[model samples]
Target chain A: MTSPLVTVTDLKVHFPIKKGILAKTVGHVYAVDGISFDIMPGETIGIVGESGCGKTTAGMAMVQLTPVTSGAVLWKGRDMAEMTRSELRALRREMQLIFQDPYSSLNPRMTVRQILSDPMDVHGLFTGHQRKERIDFLLDTVGLSPGQADLYPHEFSGGQRQRIGIARALALDPCLIIGDEPVSALDVSIQAQIINLLKRLKRDFNLSLIIISHDLAVVEYICDRIIVMYLGKIVEAADYASLYKNPRHPYTRTLMSAIPVPDPARRTRRIILKGDVPSPISPPDGCRFHTRCPDRMEICHKQEPAMRRFGNRHTAACHLYTDEQAEPVENKPKAKEKIS
Target chain B: MDQKTQASILSIQNLKTHFFSRKGVARAVDGVSFDLIPGQVLGIVGESGCGKSVTAQSVMGLVPNPPGKVVGGKIFFHHRDLLTLTVQELRKIRGAGIAMIFQEPMTSLNPVYTIGNQISEMFRLHKKLGKKQALAAAIDMLERVQIPSPHKRVHEYPHQLSGGMRQRAMIAMAMSCNPEILIADEPTTALDVTVQAQILDLMHRLKEEFSTAIQLITHDLGVIAEMADQVVVMYAGQVVEQARTVELFQHTLHPYTRGLLASIPVLGHRTLGKDEDLVEIKGMIPSLYDLPAGCRFSNRCPKVMDMCKNHLPDLIDMGGGHQVRCWLHTREMIS
Candidate 1:
């Protein structure tokens, strides 16, 4: 098999909670606790979670945007943490970030051409005559006309501005693009346009993509592999079909069912989790999701479950199944309970 | 002959709300009509600039004046016209007869006051409870909405609570007086899906317990399909289609609705083929100040005809309470 484009091992990001005038660090909020995953070349991997789950933080840490407290993020066999300032800047060109909120992400004062060229200028890639041509080409690739390059971000709609955002990410011809809730700020129809654009660009440029979103369906559409997060841990990781078709972890199963189906005919019984996600600063013991998990056993509250692998790459961290000893977990069925 | 439907709790007829700015008039809610049956959920779905929120504001008489005004039409709450009510009279019915829950709870709730202090005011105003009694009832209200440790949470301000908790507090205040109607505009849009599920479940339970009619407005069809008994599809400040929830999904008529349904990637459904592109509605929503003389959606409509370009199709009723405004559905279509 071809070597993975990026590999993140045992990553942990902790933010200290400060109190009082002295600004003493009282306790650390376990933002990303410990998570590990990898992105293959030309593959689209999605990190799915709710707010405070550290999905965004995990993505940022991989690209060296957020400070990684401890862990190794190896980019093409080189550890990113060991890189110098100039070397880190060079690494940024290979991995660019696309942000959410098209309204706030783009600078109001900058024109489309300026936004696209700023990255190129910083990187010192193209010069003079060729730089102007590259800007025009980037805008055209994103489906905007060359004439609209002079217009400021305020003149464009949400969808068009997102396209401009994508063009800026593509300015350096990066090998990877990490989008954190990229299309969540746009309308449904506009979201579709952007999703399709990203798919096309990925295929054309052979780029590895990491999309971090709270939206499961949007991620399900574009990503071939998915990692489900709860609090600050990866509860499950599987190929697209296996995760949705046969989810192993209870949290993953509940999350899959929680989303409201668009078609009225397919209204399934939604298993609403009991309480709010516990604060990351003081997350629950053992399994972070044990406090709210419906299928919590006695062991779940005392000891964290190991990631047990099923067929192929489908793995889930749950005590329900043991390695090869237990029968297929789907055989024993329980009566469906609907909460009114 | 302004006869009210006996079962309808809220009735809006030919409602027209406009914004008079320096540029020109923006017909935000032009010629919209809908009725909310008692205890039923009526969902209004559309993109931004489609005026779903403005329509809700018109019913509550909360539209800011000076620039925004109810230019025309009547808002009847059971037999009284809300548009004609004075500020004092409207305030009397505001939280008691009809209540509203905004999208952003943090912004809507006052920062300085404690949650208990804010909710107790509703009890004192509407139920005429004593100060101590009102505070007790506020805690009870918090319990009803399923907020954990209601007693301690009551003393906390808005910022102290989490996003999901703040939203529950908002819901509690709205339901404290047991209003006949609850208008929630994009209630769970800002929330995560898991929290969204929790809020939706709470709303369902409260609705069943109080039997309160809900006017739910959201852009997500998933939420609309799951909760709304009746669905009204809006485009460019006009209702393009209205039908019962199941009927609308099974037999989607309007091109805009079809485009919207097809565009969103649904969960638990078959994924699209690798080569296929998502069915996107072309072009942007028209600016309210300059809408088309014809069907407002005609400019981007995939099945537009010559007649659809010049003459607007009326919202024609096609029996069984299904109404559609498109040349394909209307007999008034001149081919």
Candidate 2:
């Protein structure tokens, strides 16, 4: 695919669980365990899962905000993990992150002007009069007036503050932007506005994005391709159209069914997962989703399924499609019987 | 679903909940009206600052005094005007007759108290039940909400339980007394999609078992479609549209309602192509502190008219219990 913009290979991030006065690492929470994906230039790749599925951690780990325990993250064919301190700082300008909470992300004490200018100053982008012009340009670019530069984050509403966050992310003209549930905290109406704005910014700047969110609908609207994660593992990955049309993994199907249909008259029965998500610190043996997967077989409980090609661009990790000799249950019979 | 059997458990007429702010009187809920039938689920959908939450709080008489006031209209619960009731009289009905489950379970729940204590306290205060009896009832309620190991879970603090479990516990506590009406404000907002489904299913079952009326306040169109029998779409502290859930989804007359429904990206083959622009309402929701004259949605409405900017559209019925307040709809009717 003509060399992808960002490639993540077998990335693992384990957070240490400390115990007692000595603070010895007794265990680890395997947040993102050996997950791999690639983001093409100017393509928006969505990473979606339920809360605590390590989607946010993966996004943070890519930006080096969180420490990666193992594996490689290559930015334009260069391994980010092996980069020197000075090199990483320069690379930070090319790859930026937009946090979830706009309220908490911004400095309450600093005015809008100071917040926008500080990033440029740190990077040594411009000086004096040029900085003022650049800040004004950024404010205008994000659809905010010049006068709003003097106002603090508290003075702005949730939507406006989010606009400032977006403006900050665009300060360095970053090639790849990782938005971690950027619009989840805003109102539905405001969320629409921000989503629309993000689309515009992406097109205008010719940027590649890795947007992480739990809301499937939000992902469906913006992302070109999507990767579905479950308990620190990639359950399914496909282009937007293929994944939504024909989800191969049972967990993916269940997740798709769970999204509430907006039309009341066209109400489809929801596929309720049997149990709560297992703790990431101690995930289940074999497939992590086997505990909640409706189409789980005996082999699924014992053998870990590898990601197998479903179609040209789609892949899924499930025993149902794997080559391990097992009689395939016909679709009609399974549809009749409630799996849960 | 017979009309005669469907008595309004809670009836609100011309309810105006205003907040006395430093700048001016913020009309949070301006002349809003609705009726909640017994054992029926009513969904109130609106963006933030649209006064859906305020309307729910006003019905419970939980609006903070001095700053906030129920300025006009009667809130009748079983034909009793709640506005006229004294504090003691209202307190008796708060937990026993009508209970409220807030959006954030962690904040709403008492951090110091165990789940068992919080649930049982409602019974002890209103029902005047003994500690032993109240504890038993609390456990039963917790089990009904599908909390695993109710015996063990009841003893755990709110912080100890997961987000989904905490929400379920909140629902259990609300339905502990088998109240006539349960007002849930964005109950599943903090929960994941799978957990959200479970919670909604539990709520649906609870309504059937207890024969309780539910006033669900949320911005999610999906939840409203699944849970609500009747839906009320609010804008800038006003009721823009009210209709049966099916009818509202099928034939949305109001521009705001249409915009909201269109904005939501549906699963399956329903989305209008990848390149199609989402029907986002152009402008932001008008600030409650300084709302414009006439229709608040007029600024964002695509089919806006000069008349819409000057005169507020009345909620007119278009047959079959479907009502909408929009200048474009009224104009089309007139022409």
Clashes of each: 0, 0
Per-residue lDDT tens digits for candidate 2, residues B45-143, read: 998889999998998888998799999998888779999999999988998899999888999999999999999998898789999999999999899
- The CA lDDT at B159 in model 1 is 98
**Whose TM-score is greatest here?**
1
Question: Each candidate's chain A: what TM-score?
Answer: 0.95, 0.94
**Candidate 2 per-residue C-alpha lDDT over A180-247 given as tens digits, one digit per residue, 9 for 90 to 100:** 99889887767878888888888999999888999887888788899999999999999988888888
The segments of candidate 1 whose C-alpha lies over 4 angstroms from its true place after superposition are A324-340, B1-4, B270-276, B331-335
DockQ (model 1, Cα)? 0.74
TM-score of 1: 0.96
Most DockQ-accurate candidate: 1
lDDT of 1 at B69: 96
